[model samples]
Target: MFVPFLIMLREGLEAALIVSLIASYLKRTQRTQWFGAMWAGVFIAAGLCLALGIFINQTTGEFPQKQQELFEGIVAVIAVLILTYMVFWMRKVARNVKAELEDAVDQALQKGANSGWPLVLMVFLAVAREGLESVFFLLAAFTQDVGYAPPIGAMLGLATAVVLGALLYVGGVRLNLAKFFKWTSLFILFVAAGLAAGAIRAFHEAGLWNSFQAVAFDLSNVLSTQTVFGTLLEGILGYQEAPTVSEVAVYLIYLIPALLLFLMPARPAASATKDAREASSARR
Candidate 1:
């Protein structure tokens, strides 16, 4: 439940940010007439994502047990990849996202009256990117646990994000977006690592992976997954009571380096500019 909530919150916030930015830009340029087209794009993209998620989830349910496991494993892997890429991508672009978005809006509106369709397309693509990411992630998360908690949590998270986004756009809230993203990125890395481990476990269950099958350790005696604390850990961090060697290895291999890289301070813009100037001078 917590896992789904947090993931949805982060994902929703990202989509909200994109929408808010686009709307803000349109208003600032006194092109508020395009607001209708912008909203149409958002709704269309959202509908597409919803339909796709339902279709995939329903289709997978009809598969045989082994096939289901295989599907789960594949989804988990894809989710990990997408989550990692998004985390790093957001980090890289956080500083310039506003400017980039404004530029994109300018390009979209360059067609004058015909710009309506182009702006719609631009917003549609942007929102759909985030929506698709959320869909994949939610699918992966749902595969791990059964029941109503995950879905409920996701809905609540998304609702909260909408409220927050509205507040932000109205200048009613002032959030430290950089810190928020940075901390969430760390949490997401952990979640992705867990997904990586879960992927290995799922593959093994599907009979596709048999290497390094030896038991790494047995925590079932000390902390069974059936317990409250254990369940929380399993849901959030992909804790395993009796994980195999492959699962443990994959978890550490992904988590360790990911953490290191994420925590490493980014090169300052000033330093980068200085280096660029030096190179240009040498070339001259």
Candidate 2:
């Protein structure tokens, strides 16, 4: 519950932040009239995302056990891919996001009298990117356990994001957007990696891929998914006892590289500040 909530909050706020940033930019430049269009894009994107989640849930509801397993495997792999991409992409773009957005808006409005669609396009693309990402993630998560928790988690996440987004716009909260994304991206990477392994497990169950089917270890004796500690591991880390060799391999393979990549400093300290300033200046 908490996990999904936090995910939604972070992702949701990120989207909200994008919308707010554009709105603020327009307001500053005496272009407030098109604000409604920006919002229309955002709301429409969000609705599409909701519809996507619903479709996944409803579609999987009728599958047999084997088909369900296959679906889970596919969804998990996709989740891992998207999450990993986000992790790397965030690291790469953290400093330049503001500049990029500002530039985009600038280019859009440069058309003068006919800049409305361009502005709307920028906001729409940004918001929809986040929305589609969230939708895929929710789909993967919903298939994992198939209950109220996933949706609840999503709602909680979005709710938290709303609060944070409001706070950010109001000029009260002090946020280090860089480090915040770093840590959360790292966490999300691991979660996605675990899901990736779980995906492998699901495929094995569905008899899709049969490579390295041996059990790495039997942790069931020490802990079961039903146990308190086990539940925590499962919820946060996507742990499964008696995981096959392929699962373990995929999980570790995904984690080590992702963690190292995430931890790798984007810039040396001596130059990072200067870069950040330059980037910020470009945006301003």
Candidate 3:
């Protein structure tokens, strides 16, 4: 649950920041009249994303119970791959995102009416990237937990991000965005590891895997989901009362590397920030 919220929140903030940058630039250049078309494009892309999400949710419901587990297991695996890629990619490439975006804007403005399609394409691609990431993550998370909470988490995250983004734009708040992204990526790494393990367990249950299915341990006797701490663990980290050997193996295999990468040295976020600033300045 926390994973979904955090993932969506972070992604939403990225998108919000991009849109805000475009909007602000338009206003500054007295091309504010283009704002209406920009908003319309944004809304259209958003609506399409919403429809796509709904379609995915409803599609998952059509499978038989056990088959659903198998399908979910597969989807979770896909989610793991994509999520892991995103974490590392961002670590390596996030700094120049702002500058790359600014260059696109400059090119579009230079073209005038030809800019309309480019603007539409840029907004669609940015928001859709975020939306696609959210859709896959929710699919994976919802499969692990039994309930209505994942969707609730996503909505909460998106709403909260929007509020925070608006405040940042309106001079109502300030955040160390570099630190925010760095820390949150670490959090997401843990979540992805849990999904890796949980999905493996699901596949075993669905008859896809047969190795190392022994019951690793049972904690239900002492700690039940009915208990507060138990429920929190279950929601936050996919804790199970009686996890199988394969589940534990998959979880740790994913967790250990993810944790190491997150904790290990990488290029400083400040360096990325500096590079981005320099790039933006060069463009200007």
Residue-level lDDT of model 1, residues 188-260, one tens digit each, is 9999999999999999999999999999999998999999999999999999999999999999999999999
Q: Write the per-residue lDDT of candidate 2 for residues 1-284, one digit (tens) a residue.
A: 65577677768878978877877777777878887778877887788877887877787789999998998888888778887887777677666666567667777767645657776676778888887777777777776666788787888789878888878877878788877887788789878987898888899889998999888999999899889989888888899878888989999998998888777767643455456556556655
How does each model score on TM-score? 0.93, 0.90, 0.88
How do the residues 1-284 of candidate 3 rate in per-residue lDDT, one tens digit apiece? 67778888998898788788788777766777777666766787788878987887798798887898898888888888878877886776566676667666666656756457667776777777777777788888777766778788888999998998888777698988888888888877777777888888878878889999889999988998789999888877778888889899888998887878767777765665666567667755
Clashing pairs in 1: none
How many pairs of residues collide in model 2? 3
lDDT of each: 0.89, 0.79, 0.79
Misplaced by over 4 Å in model 2 are: 267-284
Error of 3 at 75 (Å): 2.0
Best candidate according to lDDT: 1
Query: Among these predicted structures, which one has the highest TM-score?
Result: 1
Model 2 whole-model lDDT (C-alpha atoms): 0.79
lDDT of 3: 0.79
